[model samples]
Target: MTVSVATSSRDMIEGALARAVQFPRLRYMGSKYKLLPHLARAFADVDGATALDAFAGSGVVSYLLKAQGYQVTSNDFLNFPSAITRATVVNQTVKLTAAEVDTICGEPADDRDFIRRTFDGLYFTAADREFLDSAWSHIDLLKGHKQAIAISALVLAAARKQPRGVFTFTDLRYDDGRRDLHLPLRDHFRERVEDYNRVVFNSGQTCQTRSGDVFDLPAKSYDLVYLDPPYAPPRDDNDYIKRYHFLEGLSVYWRGQKLMENTKTKKLEKKYTPFSYKRTIVDALSRTFEQFKDSTIVLSYSSNAIPDAGTIKDLLGAVKSDIEVREIDHKYSFGTHSTAQRRDVSEYIFIAR
Candidate 1:
């Protein structure tokens, strides 16, 4: 049977992104943080359901589902996403006090000054370097949920305030030429901190964000698994996630404060053999779906095509006897942009029984 979950809450917001803490400065395409309401409406009948949000990008969909009271198992391959997903969907509770917020905002400016005072030869600005160092040093005083919320807010603020707009991933830093961009330090930090405070005080959802490959998840453990993996293929000669290396670092840190570079991966995959031409993704995913042979499966895709809508249905149809399809008009055209990608976003919602 197919169920849509659109139940309501008053002015309720998702945890991490609502605080703008997760992405910090990432402006990547197809981030679903803003698509929650639409997705909520789309999956409205999914009340009291169990879900396994596989890709868990921003955990927006997962958070919304949990907000609507779905039993959610949110997972991601990246650390920042895993941290964000957990901070928002799982550990989200209304536990911060006004005193904590006051303390966070009121940390001695002297600490920041000390950290930044040493910012002679560095990537970020003097103020930014100072704030980051100060923030990290003071983290122990932040308690449990407050620490997560503050860090989220701090990262978000740092990202927006960064002149180069780079937060996690650093390809190669230039000593000069960074001055071409200027983000006002004070206003940006305050905005991010405020957002951090708000999200900590607002969210209440039961969720978990784990860092691991999608294919590794236990089969049939989730009532639903929303997949939005990278469409770009990865191989010795294919293109893939290049600007997202910082995400790897973040996940490593979150799993228990370890910072180690992945020297194992020597180069980027520069080209993609078509999905049909290569059965790797489908093979692994299909194996996963077999475990969910009795659960609902929702797949979201776009056509820089991995498995287009029709093809996906055929794959999913192998498991469920009853399947329903709904397509949302994801309008991408915005006016007055010299370099805005206006690709059509036709999200196919497949509900299988």
Candidate 2:
């Protein structure tokens, strides 16, 4: 029989506020922001005051756990999400005040900026590029979560200006009159900062952010470990690095970054991650389970992804005594293009103890 964990008073408060508190509006494709309610229900029985969010993409899961009174340690290989996690989860009380926002915005824009030199007409407007350089300069000077909050706002602004809410190559064939392409950069940025600043609250615990491979985390026993790695699509590329590499560059301030040659997309040159590939997924899952076997594991995966649920259960079975899978009906964050494929899908949560 499947036994679920009980929710605390903090959990009840957070669950109610989860609907009220708006998360940073990110355009990431596979974000679990919409599924937080279902996820909270699935893991309600897990024994944990502390959690390690192994693949904290978009940081919604980590932030939610933090709100529910968990001491969350959020890790993602990319710098962008790590910044968000640091700002929202790890941050106990630091928030960007209204006066600070004005100071950050009033910083001088450099024409010969790194973004202008590197990304001319690639992802953003020349003006937008210049503003970003100025924003980065001021943001880099600040320490800790203050910097994180500003950076998060900038990231959100950049993503909003891009088509399809991602950094993929845009077709300029019929680009005669696109209003969104010409939206005012600074105004949008200010609005984004205001939006992010409004949501800053004390999660009641000091969290942490780590950016690197999942295996490299400090060997310590967490009460629970949540994994939400990239899904291996059947016929399309779901590689997040390729999708959000621009944001990564922006997070790192594009210092001495390597760019892909002969490609219009201008994605950053990145090393291959096994979780982004189909053939290596089983090995990745097995290794992760083995590495964190000391803690209760909660894995979020799609019903129609690589390795299949049975394979995953078998892999988890080797590491833990009990395994339970919960299936929640869900839909894609972005609409499906194929007429043959339905928009509806099932999201599976594998719980192991």
Candidate 3:
């Protein structure tokens, strides 16, 4: 069944974005959110197409596909990436009452439990920690698809109350004295069902969820393979996946683990692919493209990290009969301005047939 696309719902847009004031999700130095509209325009040829976001960070692109009423299949090895997908792209309509929000977020709970201890000395005010301490526990008792949906909502709420200041890209809330919750995630979920009711009520679905490398995608299974792998380099002598505490945190949130304090070391299982090395990067992408075979291949790459636009074009042309290159013009949302104040970025879209 087709879920009605309600892009014009202003209330949901307001409620859903309560957390947007902070670290909402799937964001990095080089994210695809700014390019989302352009990406959608480029894919104008695609309708009712089953879409896949292989590297579903923040699930923004996947959510975009979902918002467009496409059958979106999002897969990301990272924990937070998948969580955002479950919350925004593949969530169920939640029937919530204002009383439920109060019980879930406004009340007090034990702050010295394992979950609270996990975030000790971090940025979450005592009230924030207690809220999550109770809320996550409540969400955890449920099972199956409902679990994903509940946790998605709960995490958005809990992450806001965290000491780390709602949506910061930085590590901890009080680690370096930055304790302001940039975006109040709790405020977003406080309204819960009413926030994005019109949009999220229809619910979204995905094909699979696996904890594995991007190169492990099955052969000849998907119609389009969307790749949004990491653009950051690994820390000195550490694996790239190991540095993925952000992802693990989201996974833990899925399990209803409330992290009240930032810690010396992030706790979770980290997965990494051989993406930093040039040969490995090419080989892995080549294999992924090969597995899809003839499927319209659309890639999201940054001008700063991935191969030059020309190299990508040549590679795609060699792999498919047709190649379409769209230089997603730099806009206010995607950075790369003529001004000298903020960081600049340029992204490219390569379409292969």
- Candidate that scores best on lDDT: 2
Q: What global local distance difference test value does model 2 have? A: 0.77
TM-score winner between candidates 1 and 3:
3
Q: lDDT (CA) for every model shown?
A: 0.52, 0.77, 0.53
Ranking by lDDT: 2, 3, 1
Per-residue CA lDDT of candidate 2, range 1-71, in tens?
21213456555756634632587768677788777876776555676678899999888888777766677
Candidates sorted by TM-score, descending order? 2, 3, 1
* TM-score, structure 1 vs. true: 0.69
TM-scores, in order shown?
0.69, 0.90, 0.71
Better of 1 and 2 by lDDT: 2
Over the stretch 164-209, how does candidate 3's per-residue lDDT look in tens digits? Answer: 3223333453344333244344554554324333335453444444
> Candidate 1 vs candidate 3: which has greater lDDT?
3
TM-score of candidate 3 to 2 decimals: 0.71
Residue pairs with clashing backbones, model 3: 12-195, 21-183, 22-183, 23-167, 26-58, 119-261, 123-163, 124-163, 164-173
Q: What stretches of model 2 exceed 4 Å from their correct place?
A: 1-21, 107-112, 171-182, 333-342
